[model samples]
Target: MDTLQILSEQGVLGSTPTVRLQGEALDLSSYARTEDAEHLRSLYSDMFLVRRFDQESTALQRQGQLALWVPLTGQEGAQIGSGRALERQDYAFPTYREHGVAFTRGVEPAELLRLFRGVTNGGWDPRKSNFHLYTLVLAAQCLHAVGYAMGLQRDQLADPSLPPAASIAYFGDGASSEGDVHESMVFAASFKAPVVFFCQNNQWAISVPATVQTSVPLAQRAEGYGFPGIRVDGNDVIAVEAVTRWALEHARSGKGPVLIEAYTYRMSAHTTADDPTKYRLSRDELEWKARDPLLRLETYLRSAGLADDAFFEGLDTRARAAATELRESVRSMQSADLEDRFAAVYAEPHPLVQEELAFFREYEAGFIDDGQHS
Candidate 1:
């Protein structure tokens, strides 16, 4: 069946309002009161910094400083809002493009560059920040998140006094097609795992459009798993934050899993190596640009008199400084020794690893002794 017909049949396109707060025509009373002026400005700053960082990373990739970069240009609101909603005790599993989420979780930008620069297998300690490493394998983190949530359930049962904790699994519309996501959701439902399946439906999964990904709204899929699901305007940071906070609370209070389908757009290429112009039309890009997350928040802040030019200026300065620092760090990054790769393969010494390492050493020695074969 066609996507529209399928959505109609499933009643997935029913009148569930997309949660929105800051927009030209939206009623803000329902959502605007939750955050104070300072908090609003902070959210704006977070979005600004993330965008700047994304731009810098893209530039670095273009300049040949990095091997690849996944741009999160149009999805800043979805990432920042949902990311900031997490508690310190909570854990997050991110897909490879969750740069804004990492920023919100206190991950250093330089550390993030380490992975893209090919200097490290993983960047930063997951335990230290409660934010797991980026999973390049599509939909793999969803299963990991569900398992972690089940473990958290067991841990909570052992110590009732422990503070409530939830795990969030971040995936994309593309990954939704993976069997692993289905299995994760099924297990989460059966086990009543305290997890939030956060899907950033950024319109395009590489070159494929959302229309091809599924027939119904991605959020509606949660109902099949016997959990509540909601759609939030992913470009509206206020709405994203409000919905995420509510979802997190529900899961933390033992309500089981919740699915949040963030309706957003991928304004840039899927990655540095992609060319969106080959598939997506310019008119669609223009439409999403008008609904830019950063622009909406900045407009709201200015209209409400919540922030002044000085605040914006200072923020810009900070962003530039941060970008400079990241560039310098990435350029100065030292490559790991070739032996370190072999050494990290096993916790204990292994004969196979030793043999491989020996072979590699002999090969290097042969190259060093003379220009010709030894």
Candidate 2:
């Protein structure tokens, strides 16, 4: 199992990154080097902006402006590259930490914060963006993605005019161990569903290291499912984008599902409530920091002269302004009325739920009338 790596730069700054292709990754090399420096620059810009947005979100949680936050500091390469691989018709189902992917899908920074701010159950419309809501329930989105992909298959067969599309399910190494993931894969393989299981193997599942979860490379598991599995350098954004494009193409062509293991690391605490100090070593953090996705891509850009100090400076300015705007949106978010909550409990209003809402409203009125607001 040779890991596919393209921009593994141990070379000094300002030197062009050597493309390292291993295994059967030769086909992906051309895609990685599009000769369009501006494309690479755009990838860097997205990484920079998303990282800034992620940092601001963490700060919001610290300042008590958000109820909680899932930080995607280190996995920007995997998220952004795979996200951009999607065609306009392709749909994506994401786990909770896919804020980087959301940015690629045109989800606003303020929209991404609304859920953590406790102002909304869904941050954005899945139909509008074709990017589903972040599934907080671990690997559950795997099943949903497969079902949706099967539906897409049927939809295309029924109407040849519809564009052929695939679905990509984003989960983590930890979620791979869940039975729900296995079950989803079973159905996908049996039906040859047009789906790509994009696993961002971020080393640890909360406090538990990935070593405790699986003995083999997570990509190897796809072999049992009778599909191609490729492990790519998740920190190398170019490699990730190339590999994901291939996987999406394979699935859409009716070659069955493909599992892509994006071998990356999580630089931040799993969430705002997590404390990495309790379980991980400072040395590990330093080592992964050296392989930081944004830094690696930034080196490639500088070496290629694709961007300059002025461009980066401008991006920083824009990111700061965007964060400020997101903060204001969070602050201005008002809690939803309790009546709306009851209405959402069912597709149609239930008698019992209606009675509960009425009783609660009447009980609240007692405090206001008696001048005993609490």
Candidate 3:
């Protein structure tokens, strides 16, 4: 089936989407196929943890522990679902907002917070974690992911005995419009790079609506670069996980890149500084709120008899503890020395850099040695 054609038929005025994921408009019974009661309970636990982390990060930002916080108040399904789909051998490139994904991948929450808090560029090594440094530049990670996938292909060639490694690039709907993203698609397709371009179409790019970014669905654009595209109910964690797992397997098996557009809403302001109300209609907000990811999971869990008051209470307790721990960690992140930033930019210090560092060391010593603000 042509996935692009499937997308074209979706989101049209007054037209029903053929792929109505479980729990889109009905009770939680529909979501039962994806998991048994035990697994559902675990996923709910995961969602709670992610939300707790998000709330703590936000509070830290407001309290001056972090320089900024990009909250994913309503998009936990997309991140956790897509993240859970990745194999340990697979690589992932993430945009800055994918804290939930990082969390699912076992990234230490403290390390992620330190990046936004401005204590470091990236606190963790990408190679060690199976995750790349969070890309603040929109769509740049797409190119990096493509390069990584190509390198994986070369490695597979050098050692024909080795298994192929899939790469996943996470980007937003706004980033889908970037030229580098398009170039990434071109290169991935041309090289048959084993990559999945996972786009979280959260329906807003700060103040810009998805309508303004492109007339067609972002997933359909994958056809232009000779890749299949699948649009899933992003709020439905089951749907997102099922679709991403399928897409990732296809890519890993040498089918090249697949664009999985998880159709979700951006429930929060774009960032701490963004006022979504300035540009978004209240009606749209209300409509999207009704599709809240956590609510859906809650409904499903209750209907399936997978979660009870005890379950919820346990989750709440864990969430609270996590938040407290995260708060402390954010507070404890020590500021890096200013010189360390310049030191890592080169292998051996160049002559000019040596001279500048020497001058700065002396110049800085003249001032108070406390590196509090530096």
Which of candidates 2 and 3 is the stronger one according to lDDT? 2
Count of clashes, each model: 0, 0, 0
Per-residue accuracy of model 1 over 152-219 as CA lDDT, tens digit each: 99999999999999999999999999999999999999988999999999888899988899987898
How much lDDT does candidate 1 score?
0.86
Give the TM-score ranking, best first. 2, 1, 3
Off by over 4 Å in 2: 1-26, 355-372
What's the alpha carbon RMSD for model 3?
4.8
TM-score list, all predictions: 0.90, 0.92, 0.88
- Cα lDDT tens digits, model 2, 1-374, are 12236332221222333323233434565456557788888998999999999999999999999999999999999999998889989999999999988888898889988889887788789898899999989899999999999999999999989988999999999999999999999999999999999999888999999888898778878988888888777887887898888889989999989998888899999999999999999998998899898998787677778889998999999988988888888889887888887788899979999999999999888778457686
As a whole number from 0 to 100, the lDDT of residue 4 in candidate 3 is: 13
Write model 3 residue lDDT over 1-374, tens digit each, in one string: 11111223344322232343221322223323455677667766777898888888777888887778898988888888888878888999999899888887888989898788888878898877799998999999999999999999889989988876899999999998899999999999999999999999888988888888988777778877887877776776766766777778789888899998888888887888778889989898788787777887898788767788998998899888878888777777788887887787798878888788889888877775475534
Point to the candidate with the largest TM-score.
Answer: 2
